[model samples]
Target: MAEQKQTVSTDDGLILAPADEKQNAVASELEGSGISSPAEYEDLPDPDIGKTDAERAALDKALLWKIDLWLIPWLSLLYLLSFLDRTNIGNAKVANLEKSIGMVGRDYNNALTIFFISYAGAEPLTNILLKHWSPRYFFTGIIILWGIIMTLMGTIENQAGLLACRWFLGLAEAGLFPGVNYYLSCWYRRQELGFRAALFFSAAAMAGSFGGLLAAAISKMDGIGGYEGWRWIFILEGLATVFVGCFCYWMVFDFPDTARFLTADEKLRAMRRLRADNQTRATEEKISRRYVFQAVKDWKTWVYAVQYMGVLCPLYSFSLFLPTILVGMGYKGNRAQLMSVPPYAAAAAMTIFIGWFADRTKWRGYSNMAVSLMGCVGFAMLLGSSTPGVQYVGTFLGAMGIYPCVPNTLTWASNNVEGSLKRGVMVGIVVGWGNMNGVVSSNIYMPQDKPRYLTGHGIVFAYMFTCLFGGTMVMHFMLKRENRLRKSGQRDHWIEGKNEQEIRDLGDVRPDFIYTT
Candidate 1:
């Protein structure tokens, strides 16, 4: 059958063309309308311009709720397990896993370091592969693999066995974080991302709080079936993760276009709504090497990575050491585990609230800076106070400040990038770099630095300050400068006269692509 030709309007005028000629027609129309470059096309009317406000609002609410119901819970659960399995070693350490395994000196730290090294190293490659595979299969496969590795952790008879399990565990878990971020971006608009990202990330905070309680209860099962409580912690939690993965495999939605829950009209509405946001369109475009190269060349990826690292190093240390910190503050056994719960609980609540606020205000960079300052104050309190009560308060402040920034930074990177491949690569790079600091975190606090851990607190404090400065500079200088250039009629030649596919391939460097600050 012959292709049907159709008439479409552009800024210049209406033109008759085949459906497949849309890009060329639009480009010609744009060129004829004094829009010589893509930068000048920023003011083009939204693709959803025909929709009434009432219609849009109703559709948006319905679509968002549907997505929230179908997507967030499953993703959050996955992240929760990822965080729990990774950080459960911390809980186990306090439960005497070290004595059982004969881990001495910096051996525990080395185990943590090795996990992150593999975790960070595998991220980029995993993300690229995720782009090629079905999200449901890819995600479920990794979760299952990691769950198996996590279960094997309980069976480790020596440090070498533990180290090998952690290494493979990291490799299994590497794809989830960045892959989910990129996946979410494909479905939701930038403004809607913060809370969703938070919704996903607050699971980590929940894991911290819940892991403590679970570990405490499981610790009571020591010497059961010839397994210690710490061993039971790994075995039980790992099994639970595997169970969830198996159950939720069918619930995972690939993208808006391929979502099973949505009706045909709803699917079209979802895609149109995203396109109207003037961001990258969600499509299963083949992984392009050019997009990967573009993402690598984009300085924002590295900048965001560096900024994220400052937060991650401290956050990782905190997650891995909070129980120990509580123990040092005079809580003992199950009491210390229970005591570690409140801070994470508080952080979880604050993470959701801040995510909502950031989305509402559309000021991600400012929100990040504010949270970093809060973290600085929290660390200051820890440094200044010797009293346990005051230090416990510091933990609350630290948790609140640190946890929110994770989602914020993740969303911020997703918001600024365009194109699936570029976004995927960028998310991978940023998250990979951020997690790389887990190495630094692992070694930052030694066993000798117990109780106060002054050196650890000080290092985190300094990094918080660096995060503040970096956030400020990026918002005021980099993003602002790009916005100004585009607003002032300056054009990025890279996108000039490009067809739709070419422009999409250009990612955020496209002249019309405005960076959200």
Candidate 2:
């Protein structure tokens, strides 16, 4: 089919084509995108109106590099600490946290389950606070709070004490993952978000690698200060986290409009680029009850939530159990910790590459579906195989396949949502609901299923398969059909009588707000 010609309407409501080849070229860029009226068209000013294509590209590259240097590294460090602190219980378990605390029967699983209960419950509410308090203050406060909680965890003498610490830790950590994701959406364009999100998320993969090596080294510190190796692990890592959190107050930038690192020209371009990127809505908007209701009403929000749940279930299972799985593979003590590093290291490399690939191809759902299949195959191997070597290989495949899907899935959801408040609400709900899958993961890798954890492997395999066929594929087709309808002008009726503010407030409900599948 030929590209649809874009039109504008004047005060008299006369429809006309763009005046010249330049305006036509500009309009053609948003071809099939349902821009509601001439007013909405004017809102998305051409970023390259005066500059040559090469000049615009060069400037964009330099600006992105500056943004990346300031944003990605610090955010990645924060998440690295958060993930390490959250999952370090697994490492602590390997070092005999259960034996140390006299945890018996289901006590270990209960501890893990309690964390997620608090975590998922706190997630939706915490993102609201992120906007209210500002990223710098909010992140610094939570990071320090969690760090203190984690440090005290080292001193816990019993199961009750441990559970209490874990619960508070969950509340403190509830914000960081989803908070950083929403924060990223504030600065980057749709196409740029996936790769940046990947870079930030890959830090979690690196933390897994780092955690294993660090835990191995720390476990040797047993009896150094009348503390077990696991105790030392918590104390040292907690201190490091607190240090980073203190630095975050200075290092973390707020939104782009108020970013201190950018020049006046750079700030203007940053805002303009985002306006051009999201054609139908303002780049930034105040939080409103209406947006919260709109986000809750959007069916796409729930679909994304379910899709996120599918991937996170298996991802959590794999991350929390990999060391135990390796120990079951016959690697003992610190050696088991050492062996866990390779899978996460491989996963970190693969995640960054897949993120770049997804952004380059603009194939978020497709990338997720493909990776989900890889995860299914990996879990199938773990379920079917008897040999330790085969199961070890499965770990590599599982880590690599599952890790990348997170950033892709998140960016896919963020890409489709318009306006800041609505996007934040949608992301918060999706993340909160998705993280509830951690409960399922924590309980499934039962103590009875050790060595050949068949039941756990089978269930996680099913989850990954669901991510492939039931989640990403379904969402892809839904978005594709919506785009097709908008291209045919079938959705134009949505904007017929709305004024400019009404149209802007309608956000993605507007006909021309194209969906990125």
Among the numbered candidates, top TM-score falls to 2
Indicate which candidate wins on lDDT: 2
Q: Residue by residue across 83-168, what tens digits does model 1's lDDT show?
A: 99999999999899899989899999999999999999998877788767778889989998999999988999999999999999
RMSD for all candidates, in order, please.
7.0, 4.5
In the range 252-371, model 2's lDDT, one tens digit per residue, is: 988887889998767766776666565222335666788889889999998998889888888788888888889888999999999999999999998999889988877888888888
Error of 1 at 141 (Å): 0.3
RMSD of 2: 4.5
Q: Give candidate 1's TM-score.
A: 0.89
Question: How many collisions per candidate?
Answer: 0, 1
Clashing pairs in 2: 34-512
Candidate 2 — which residues are off by over 4 angstroms?
A: 1-22, 25-53, 279-284
The C-alpha local distance difference test score for the whole of candidate 1 amounts to 0.82
Give lDDT per model, in order. Answer: 0.82, 0.83
Off by over 4 Å in 1: 1-53, 468-472, 492-505
